[model samples]
Target: MKDFPSCFGENGVQIADSSSSSSSSSSSISKAAQNLVTCVYQCKLRGRLSFIVLTWTKHLMGQGLSLQIQNSTSQSLCKVDIKPWLFSKKKGSKIFEIESSKMEIHWDLTNAKFGCGPEPEEGFFVAVVFDRELIFFVGDSPSEKIAAVSAAAAVFVARREHVFGKKLYSAKAQFSEKGETHNVSIECDTSGGLKEPSLVIRIDSKTAMQIKRLKWKFRGNDTIVVDGIPVQVMWDVHNWLFGNSAMSSAVFMFQTHKSSGSHSQSSVLNSSSSSSSSSSSYCQQQIKDSKLQGLDFSLILYAWRNE
Candidate 1:
């Protein structure tokens, strides 16, 4: 066994090639071994293998739905195609059903540029099935992760409320280090639609998972009070270390025309309504010395399931 380079794990095993064999055979074995390692690592990190077992043994045993990391990176991901396999295995069987209205992708970025540019400096992609509305995040970092998670959770809660025909009033969001928690207050109507329901999402500083930073943009017909005119506006949310410390703003205002025939003047406003408790000195240092740029990077994300 010593002659066989071995790597053992609770989940699987890896056997490396041995040079004490015929030259041609050894080369082939070495290549095969390397490929196996790559495949195994990808499967472990993407969580596909674990999900497959859970689907089959869910009722017979006790196990939290968890994924093992064989290898992880920003560009590539591989795992057991559980959903498709389940479909294939369940052909002609009416015993089980899975229901979800939407699927989404989330990216976890380890290193990024986040520089002043028209496009995101760097990020990753993630895909998952949810209760409603397919969502996708372009960047992956602590802040981006928090935003994506919060959005997913909120969308789920909103879908549930919609089912009972509740009247929702408003939706607001907050974040923390603990995790993304949402508080939605709705008037249960038993009817099929809502009149006035409100949702407030809170993200703590703790459960950011493995994200390191985040940034986002909101575009649409959003207006806010500025001086006296109701100015059209957009927002940006930036966070690092998850929601532990962050900055958010809806300060950008549309600039109205000043020339003849134009009635309103508008311009974008950037408010520094930061959520970070740290002083300005710390923020400056963070911006200057951030480590999210310049790295030979690879990340594999389970951007989609078999289904």
Candidate 2:
């Protein structure tokens, strides 16, 4: 697995590649591995403020979900993996120890409703309880809300989306918990031997921002508006402009507020969250150094250019 430092480029994060796939097969194994969505939450676990990372992935083999929690001190609170290959692993509760505190994790996805991605859109509930107080949840249904009210509050801080496209990339985002999902589209033409490429970002089919001189401004940031809310935008088109076969991906970021996080890191986690039998300091270090404090929502995009 490539560490964040080595895998990330200046323009965007590189997501996936498959050298084994035949060109005739449009959606190859490599393409399926890149379909991923991740959510990060800033919450308190056992009175220790922490960042919890939840990732949902889709591949030709199957679907998977995983969670990792790290505290302010960069201690690993817990990590869980759900693979439905076996019937016994579908829905269950887990108990673990963090700082001598019994952490309870409850998840029920057997009856969950899923969208195109591995993430369940509804009909599911996952909770983390520390010292018997609910700390985090992944649902907003009425029942989920009631349970959340009794638990310690957590904030949705950021999201990392892995998307595939040729020239035009599209995705959906909810700036806030109460905000409506908006259509986000990124259009850039770096091919056709144009002396200077251009980039355009649109929300709801309305152009929010554009960059005309791409060569000089391959890595830069701007701001846009969605549902009357202001969003900060950042782009890195280095790969689309100067990449060889080994490096052919760009990355973009859309955020509601300014945050201090590692731009060099890709949201797609290739490391095992359950590998360590002792500590999760490495994983926590990545999230801790991200400096996501006081930030609300961040959308990190890893844009891979298809050749």
Candidate 3:
């Protein structure tokens, strides 16, 4: 497995290849693995920059959750894992000592409602308190019992999720912090031999981008406008077309690029014909470098094809 720092580089964007062995193995896991989602949030702990990672997983037995607090250097300050079968431990709190400061984590999942994914769709809250002050919290609604305290809000930095489908894969994404969540779908027909394979991406059911010759452009980047903001859409589908196993998956990344404009879009589209290796590296560098400027949001989707 890739280290947390390497997966989420200095800019808070994932840097590994989507089609690598690590990604493939992760995608090939059991059906329960499809319920996994990892989200990274940036916030302040004791006035110092830190990250809070929440990983949600689902198993045959039940839903599982893990939380980790890391400093600017990606060093773990505190880690908590909630076992899936521990139904009685749904509502609880834990305290940890970090550099002489006390950090408290409280969670209430007894009334949590879950959808197809492991993450609760509503009716739950996870709160983090540092030095007796509320630092971060996430959920549909906060309980009246947990007092509301004023503090710096956490920034949603990045999310990595696994999606499964045969020809159409869909997920929800928000390009900006305050942006509206939109339905993002990817469609490609590689099953039939009669017609040439092509790729199509849609936002809110409208076609945002399309690639005519997917075989030649299996791994490339394109610029698509979302919420009037320029987003760089990079995809790697080499495994879908040529992998030996049916479980191989394709990887897609949707990133908001504040610096990208209309002029650069045409240039990037023209350069899509470059070799896959160079194109993949160039796209990775583009995201890695963009993160240094504090890009708000990035979404990585591993689309697994079901046989």
Candidate 4:
């Protein structure tokens, strides 16, 4: 079946709308650790985000883990200070800020849903593209949590369709130790099973993201540039978001945009287009996925200010 791209195949996701809250009991690393242990038991019972503190010894402490979030609100949101609950000394804890208007922060420390298996070596990353700017952030994460993050990133990338139209921007995930720069690409395709749409993503050019059924747009052999980068993408509409009998292919493109002054160069290749009958099948699939998923996973509906 066309599965969710392993990385970020399409750009949108159906997230359970959650509220925002904080936890700050304050004791020490031990307290945080105990809290981390206790909080896992409470995840399914609570709504909104939660935090858990981890400790090394009965006295010494480490830090607090909080749920990461991406706020697409039009208002300029500021960084929240949860350091007081995490550190004993004024400078004990540090708050890292993601520069993008849409950013991700550590959400929690427990992996209750995925079950515990050596902690899963998780790190959190969020990718956001605004206008000409694209930014992604990485923090210590576990495998289970990373899966959640990958799911979120796929949703974020899918939303680009509504903003840019025809899958204008794609999103990818990255990982790091000391927090530095990295290069990643978001790929969207629809050439697999005929049941559910999957999302696939790639990490550091190796791992494939789990994404399915993107709004396929450009046929392979199309080259585009974005933020000075070059990307060659292939698109399949019959399997993206619209469904099998729709009128359009779920548009799937890479991060880079078509180089300026190069439209004439691609005129011939661009001239060949899919027929209305082909689009009909694709649109049917897109609608089917939307009905099953129950969210506007189709980026086309939300990419612009007025979609």
Output the number of the TM-score-best candidate.
3
Q: What is the C-alpha lDDT of each candidate?
A: 0.22, 0.63, 0.74, 0.28
**Candidate 1, superposed: residue stretches over 4 Å from native:** 1-26, 35-101, 105-123, 127-129, 132-146, 149-307
| Candidate with more favorable, higher TM-score: 1 or 3 | 3
State the weakest 10-residue window (summed lDDT) of model 3. Answer: 1-10
Q: Which stretches of candidate 3 lie over 4 Å from their true place?
A: 1-32, 86-88, 259-263, 266-283, 292-294
- Which of 2 and 4 is the better model by lDDT? 2
lDDT tens string, model 1, 101-201?
A: 22222233234333321123455322332333222223344443334453422111000000111122222221121323333222211121333211121
Question: For each candidate, C-alpha RMSD in Å?
Answer: 24.7, 9.4, 3.6, 20.4
For model 3, residues 1-307, the per-residue Cα lDDT tens digits are 1111223535342322223444445344535447778888888776777888888888777888888888777778898889788454888889999879888888989889998788998889898888877888998666664566655568877788878889999999989877899999999887868899899999999999999778777776777888888887877777687777757567787877666456234223322455434434655665675566445577878788887
Listed per model in order, the count of residue pairs whose N, CA or C atoms clash below 3 Å is 55, 4, 0, 106
Any runs in candidate 2 off by more than 4 Å, and if so which? Answer: 1-33, 84-88, 140-149, 258-294
- Candidate numbers, best TM-score first, in rank order: 3, 2, 4, 1
The candidate scoring highest on lDDT is 3
Q: Write the per-residue lDDT of candidate 2 for residues 232-301, one digit (tens) a residue.
A: 6766676577655533556677766443232332232211432232112332333333334333577877
Model 2 TM-score is 0.74
Q: Give the least accurate 10-residue stretch of model 4, judged by summed lDDT.
A: 37-46
User: For every model shown, what is its TM-score relative to the native structure?
Assistant: 0.17, 0.74, 0.86, 0.21
Ranking, lDDT, top scorer first: 3, 2, 4, 1
